[model samples]
Target: MNDADLVDNLTALESLLQVTFHDRTLLRRAITHHSCCPDTAVHDSYDTLEFLGDAIISAHVVEYIYRTHPDASEGEMTAVKSEVVSRRVLAQVGQQLGLFPFICVDIANLRTFNERSRDSLCADVLEAIVGAIHIDQGTEVAREFVTRTVFPMIELVSTHAIDTNPKGRLQKVVLQRTGHLPRYRVLEQSGRHNDRVFLVGVFEQEQLIATGKASSIKEAGRLAAREALQLLQKKDKRSSADDTTA
Candidate 1:
C-alpha cells in the first residue's frame, strides 16, 4: 500500500485497538505480509515481530492463568495457558477485529489464500501487532491489550475444558475399562503437501472404535480419540444396563 492508504488503515486500526502508535512504521510492519507490496520495504514483514509477540503472549497468558486460578494444578494452568495463547484463539481474535483488510500484501497471494493459510496469517498479524504495541507504547499498554483481548478466553476454557488433551483423556478411559491403551493408525491421506488431509482411526484392543478426518495427523488423531471416547461411553452405558437386567 502507498503511504496515504497505509495511513488510513493505521488510523482506522488505531480506533479499533484504542491505542495510537508513536512509530507508525512499527504498525505498518506488523500488518505487512511478506508478499510483495510496492510501498513496503522488501525486508519489512511481521516475522520478527511475530516471534517477539509469541513470547510475550505466552508469558502473559501464563501469568494470567497463574494469578486467576490459585487452586488450579500446574498441569491445569499449563493447559489453560496453551489454549489461550494458541494460534486458533489468536486468529479468532484477529477475525473479530476485522484485521485482514488492513494487512498489506500482494493481491494475487491474498486472492489465492485458503482458510488455513488465512487463519495463520491472521494469527501472525495479531501477535505482530502486540509486539509493535510493546515497542511503540510500553509493556504496560501491551499487557492491557492482551488482557482485554486474550484473557477473556480463560472463562471459555474453564467452562468447556477444551484444553484437555483428547488423546490422554481417551487413554485413561481405555485403560480403566480394558487395561489397554488406545491406539491410533493413519487410515488414509489425501491432498497436496501444503494442504494435506488425514484420516485416522482409534483402535481399542485391535478393534477400530472410531475415526476422524482433519488437516493434520495430530488433529486427526485427537478427533479420532474424541470419537472413540464417545463410543466407549455408549458401550459402557449399554453394559451397565445389561448387568442391571441380569
Candidate 2:
C-alpha cells in the first residue's frame, strides 16, 4: 500500500478504535508486523509498539479488575488476569476485530500457514493498537479503550468457561478440593496423514468420566478434560447439597 492508502487505513482503524492518533506514524508502526520484512530497520512494524502496549495493557487490566472486584482474592485475580492476557484470548480478540486481512506477513517460503504465529502477530498488533491509543489520547482514554474492548471480550468468553482451558482451571480446583490431579489418555487415533483424528479420555482414579475427539491430540485431551471438569463440578455441587441437608 502507498502512503495515501496507509493513511486511509489508519484513519479507519482509529475510528474503529474510537481514538485518534496524534502521531500517525506510531499508529502505522503498531500495525506492521516484523515478518513483512527481513531488515530490522523497517519503521512500519508493530513490534516496538507491541512491547510498549503490553505493559500498558497489563497495568490497565490489573487496575480495572482490582477495583471492579474488590471482594475477589489474590488467587482469583491472578487467574482472571492470566485468562485475559493469554495469547489465545488476544488472538480471539484480533480475529473478532477482523485484523488478519490487514496484516502483512512473509509466507512465501513456508509450506503451511502457521496458525500460532499468525495468532501471535494478531495479539501483538492488538497490544500495539493499545499503545497507539495511549499515545494519541491520554491514560484515561486508553483505560476506557481497554475496558470497553478487551474486558468485555474476556468476560464473554469467561462466562460458562466457553472456549477456554477449562481442564486447567478444573485441575486447579480439583487439586484444592481433593489433593489429586486428573489424567488424560489417548483412546484412539485414526485417519491418515494431514487428516488424522484423535480421541482422548479423561480419568480420575482410573475411571473415565469424559471423552472427546479432535484433529489434534492436545485438542482432544483438552476437550475431554473440560468435559470431565464439568461433570466433577456437578458432582461436587450435589455432594455439597447432600452434606448440607444431612
Candidate 3:
C-alpha cells in the first residue's frame, strides 16, 4: 500500500486496538515483515518488537497469574502461564483479533503463508504491536493493554486445556496417528503403598515411546503422557521441516 493507504489502515488498527496512536510509524513497522521491507538491518521486520513484546507480556502474565490465582500451586500457575504465553495460543489470540488480513509480508513470501503459519504471523504482529504500545505509551499502558486483551484469552484457552489430562491427549494423538491406542504398563513399584513410587511405560502397540516415575500409577501414567506429547511435538516439527525442504 502507498503511505496514505498505510496511514489510513493504521488509523483503523488503532481503532481496533482501542489505543490512540501517538506515532503511527511504529505500528506500521510492527505489521511489516522483513521480507516486505528490507530497509533496516535485522529489524526491518517486526523481530525486535516481537522480542520486546515477548518479555513484556511475560512479566505482566507472571504478575497476573500470581495475583489472580493466589491459592494455586506453583505447578498449576506454571501450567496456565505456559499455555497462555505459548506461540500456538498467541496465534489463536491474534486470529481472534482478525489480524491475518491486516498483516504485511513480502509478496514473494506470500507462497509460504498457509493457514498454520499465517497464525504464526499473526502472533508475531500481535507481540510487535504490544512492543509498539510499550514504546509509545509506556509500561503502564502496555500492561493495561495486555491485562485487558490477553486475560480473557486465558478462559478461552482453559476451556480446551491440555495439561488437565495429558494421558487422554496422548491417547487421542496415538490413535489418530497409528489407528491404534497406546497402552500403559507399570514397570515397577517401590516403598509402601501409601508412599509408593511407580514406574510406568507408555507403548504404541508394542513399541515403547517413553517412561516415567511418579508417586502413583496414575501420576506416572500422566508423566509418560507428557513425555509422549513432547516427543510428538518434536516429530511434528521435523515433519514440517521436511515438507518445507521438499
Which of candidates 1 and 2 is the stronger one according to TM-score?
1
Give per-residue lDDT, candidate 3, residue 161.
52
TM-scores for the candidates: 0.62, 0.60, 0.63
Give the lowest summed-lDDT range of ten residues in model 2.
154-163
Instruction: Report, for every candidate in turn, its global Cα lDDT versus the true structure.
Output: 0.82, 0.75, 0.82
Q: Candidate 3's C-alpha lDDT?
A: 0.82
Candidate 3 wrongly placed segments (more than 4 Å): 39-43, 158-246
Model 1 TM-score, all chains together: 0.62
User: Best to worst by TM-score, what's the order?
Assistant: 3, 1, 2
- Please provide, for model 2 over 153-219, each residue's C-alpha lDDT reduced to its tens digit, 9 standing for 90 to 100: 5455444453466677757755665678878899999999899999998776577879989999989
Cα lDDT tens digits, model 1, 113-150, are 78877788889999999999999999999999999987
Model 3 TM-score (2 dp): 0.63
The Cα error of candidate 3 at residue 11, in Å, is 0.5
**Candidate 2 deviant stretches above 4 angstroms:** 41-43, 109-112, 157-246
> Residue 192 of candidate 3: its Cα lDDT?
92
lDDT of 1: 0.82
